[model samples]
Target: MTDAPDQIPEPEEGAAADSAEHPESLGDDGEFGGVEEFDADARDAADAVYAALLERVGEGAPRPRLEPTRRAVELLGDPHRSAPVIHLTGTNGKTSTSRMIESLLRASGLRTGLLTSPHLERFTERIRIDGESVRDEVLARNWEEIEPFIAIVDAELEGAGESPLTFFETFTVLAFACFADAPVDVMVLEVGMGGEWDSTNVADGQVAVITPIDLDHQSRLGNDVVEIARTKSGIIKPSASVVSARQQDDVLKVLENAADLTESTLAVEDDAFAVISTTVAVGGQLVSIRGLAGSYHDIALPLFGSHQAQNAAVAVAAVEAFIGSGSVRLADEVVETGLGAVTSPGRLQIVGSGPTVIVDAAHNPHGAGSLVASLGEAFDFDEVVIVLGVLADKDATGIVDVLAGLDARFIVTNPGSDRAADTDRVAGIVATRVGADRVTVIERLDDALDEARDWATEGEKRAVVVTGSVVLVGDAIAIAADRGWNAR
Candidate 1:
């Protein structure tokens, strides 16, 4: 990693010339044309593909191994190696950071492929081609072609007294194949979980971006921050340039050790680069970032929160490292256009109006903390109605503890997943923290949202926040669209 200078420097003449020429358009249609619609036949085919994937082991039960994915991809000609990868792994900001990286890359004239986890609405959302979700026809066709190779791997694993390729493992393979088929110039990959043995680790990332290591997925990743950091640091491959967000001292030590062992250079937030300042703006916030190669002033980021601003800084550095080895400054316009067009769905996203409805996927305590801070910074409300749901494996008590600080009423509900924590249990946790007078138990999500929206309508400066699980946020987004909450 390059050392930061005492003062920011202006770009030398022709510095922007080396940057890739801006494309006529970023996608086949246009920027933000939206996901393509599926015909009945295409929908059925896509549904069949999803059903087949569901038949395998679920994402919750990930096999902490890479050989199976390696074997499958190897048989498919190692599609993961087809493009230079910018890989990201972290607790809270992985998805958002990945989106920022992909957007910046795309704006710089690269045909980008992105893979993110646990989709909010559709399976195709996990794999994006040039800033849009992969089309259903393309997804179905790719699945049809890869099914044979997947079956071969499954039989091989089963023959060796092991389970079949798990959902994430196979999904990782499929995503790689899709990107390779698209022949993307670059791929931004987000790990499904901890990095070391996560199936996505098969690809050597040219730039490994770590976004703020924190405590989450304790049972699977580790029992503490150090253990989790050690697991995530596994993505720092040989001679890779690593860019990381601000982290705890202990976690930084773990990443530093891994980088040293791999002979990789590590650049951390506040050391290599930083968010100089941020001011809340109309739709989002205006940020000034001091990047590894250059300084960007007042870039408009459409996402909310200081965490997102931090994520943007890390992304800028990652792109700097990938494109110019942290030496050449990105074109000022590139930074402006890229950051300006970025969007992170379900992270502080407002899906409705009148009685404003916001949905965030802050399922863990660290994420919950960021959510509360962003809410305080971005929105003003006399009262907040929190429609909360939690997954069974999450730390409900810890999440509720963080949320209890808000001057808000809690409506505990299920997120419509089998993994949803019991409403009574979560409500009990909320009541203990905020008193019974502030708690409401709604067994169904739709009814819960309706009830919350009605209450918000009765008061001024009141909003409904649906959070706790990503699934719940997705459900809320759909419900908001269905009921025309934004129209009202």
Candidate 2:
């Protein structure tokens, strides 16, 4: 990995220089210059940035290589190296765990930059600084400064008869550049895909966190848990501290091997740390965590699910490893304040009341199972109407089978992505698993959610749950806000 430069390089001649000199045009202090009129202009510029990124290969089609991103960052003065990174990778819980780690670091009086994938709402949500989304002007300005360098790399790749940078590759460069421009004290990065060659892996992580490795993404990573585990273990850098959730024995063996090869110290859940107890509470739960250095008691985590409790344990261990190298115990107040303020949007998030609409981005069987378990433990609904949608590439059958165990009525719909699975196809799978009487198909997401919520409102102790895909959960959240579902 490249070492961080002693200082951020001055803007080079040409586009970079032009961008640097136009700070007022972008905004003052990365705000819209306090001019109500400039808000539209700032938003337009940010939209243009997303449009330009969408022109490349989409994130679903990730290129399993890093040199392209490495070269781009190298040209941009290696922005990714400007701060220490706590990198996380796995099938699920990566985003949630990354947020917790970032919060803990920020609470400890460090400015932090965070990068997570496939944002539920705006693309800007993927990159956060000090617990908030990076401002529109900042995102646009960084893209403008780096666009010229990206073009240079695109031309070079074409001349060599190779594909240009993919969407994730270019975005990885942008996120790193933004964080370095902010000059954050630390970074918590979530890998976009399998870790070995994911664009984010271009930066070496001081702490490598592996959430539970599972069988999702079989087409790209591997067809089994062990193969996927090996691919996910790629983030374990030489002599780095590795923290992982409890895994299948075979998966643990894979992580152990990776840590041994890298000469990194490996800590596993239930071994180095664990969730000792969890009590369901208002808005979320309280848990005791056996951390690497010490035990944390009755920590308030405002997220549901035992899986989330496990994720909290992993996050605590990760922060312990990063801040004190697993030697210094964090203050109890830091742990309480950090975790208390943590939020995992679209992961068992409550968007509405009355009929009680909820949204969870659980697209795979493992995530679906977690949703089922969390639902069972966290809510006492006599009836449930689940608004389900999934992407074409996901395991619709397995997901349906798992959710069927919840014994809830299902409304299948498209998640409004180009890759969304057909409503009829997913409905057929759901019907086969849970019987036709329990299944309904609604092509439009808004209509599906309306039907589910209306049905839920008819009975006492009934609720609506929107799950199956992140895009659908995002759509539901927006719809809930627009229709004032949460107000009811």
Candidate 3:
């Protein structure tokens, strides 16, 4: 995360294999781990910087509020100017897609940087340079260094009487400082929310990546696909190229039109680049991509679900277009390594062997459909025990119906969050659709998970799939870590 801001080479299996293949590069002067060495405990600076950032957030231009972003950048001498980046935006698959790109780039023998969001475990997960998370010590040092200037910005903003910067906004500035200081070769950025006003949009990316556009944050982005796509497409720069995954024609047209208006090159799946072949494999998915400008053969991505195949196509297309822009040339080995090395938690992530455990962030109908489709092709479970929690904004019934076909027993729980969906409300939906006897509403997530585990019948291995809200799955991941549930 921007908080740690240390250079790190992603600890990818492919990269490790590459080193083993060429042992000569494993020396002291050879390709180093992205992050050298640092303490992870020192978030004091991030806390301090965040405190200072909170003060000047609301005032007008030139004030410390939102404008301190620019002031801080200026203070840092505009470090982002030095690094070329590929920024990812969309409703779903941003984090997975970005990580895939980072691994791919690292396989090419070039240093890589990964900047994602909504970290499941730690804040440092957001800003990773080379391969390791930025050290917390570095973050604290920057906060201390920036304090006096932050105070100046706060004073100026207070004089102007403007609203303060939001939490996400201040974090955006801190991320830039972390990345700039790391001096990464290239950065993979995933947007926080709507692309237009999102902090990541401030950077002029070398390429803009748009994943499957859908409706999620209707309160901010919009109520429909077109309006939502419009906001997410804001990350596209005038001089940069744009890469998009498969989309409904109307939504695709909006992005295509935007690219045309900006005089930027546009490539869409099935139009420029596409997934030529896909199949469920012994381990994961076997995929093929036809890049608009080139073609990639069978790329083995060990991530289950059909959605992952699509995400892989987009990542490949992005790297192709990014390199085709006459800047970087991604080697075939690099592309293969990247696709094979990616891992996104709770997105059909399977944990344990006895009675398998799979977790996904399928908070809406669209994502739920993909999860179901992926599970249908990948496993043979006689009974599906679903540990789910949804947010207030999600379509709980719609999502429930999407996975209703399976031999499912619903265990609903609410992680302690203001926006978490009520377990009783969700149980009602399950009761009406499936049956009252099959539904159990449990308030505590840990209790619900235990209930799901208990539902496993002997001789017929029952798997637990934790889904619904990110907050729910995030908590599940945390619990899994605490109890050693992840190792299985």
Total clashing pairs for each candidate: 0, 0, 32
TM-scores for all candidates?
Answer: 0.93, 0.93, 0.86
In candidate 1, what are the lDDT values of residues 1-488, reduced to their tens digit? 11221222223332222111111113346343432343678767877899999998999989899999999999999999999999999898999899888888988999999999988877778888877777666778999899999999989989999999999999999999989998799999999999999999999999999998888889999999999999999999999999999999999999999999999999999999999988877667778999999899978777778899999999999999999999999998888777777767789989899989999999999999999998888777889999999999999999999999897899999889999899999999999999999999999999998899999999999999999999999888778877887622
Better of 1 and 3 by lDDT: 1
| Ranking 2 against 3 by lDDT, winner | 2
After TM-score superposition, the amount by which residue 444's alpha carbon in candidate 2 deviates from its true location, in angstroms, is: 0.5
C-alpha lDDT of candidate 3 relative to the true structure: 0.72
How many backbone overlaps does candidate 1 show?
A: 0
- Pick out the ten consecutive residues of candidate 3 with the lowest summed lDDT: 18-27
Off by over 4 Å in 1: 1-38
List RMSD in Å for every model shown. Answer: 6.2, 8.8, 6.8
Candidates arranged by TM-score, highest first: 1, 2, 3
Which 10 successive residues of model 1 have the least lDDT summed?
16-25
- In candidate 3 the C-alpha lDDT for residue 375 amounts to 80
Residue-level error in angstroms, candidate 2, position 45:
0.3
Q: If both were scored by TM-score, which would come out higher, candidate 1 or candidate 3?
A: 1
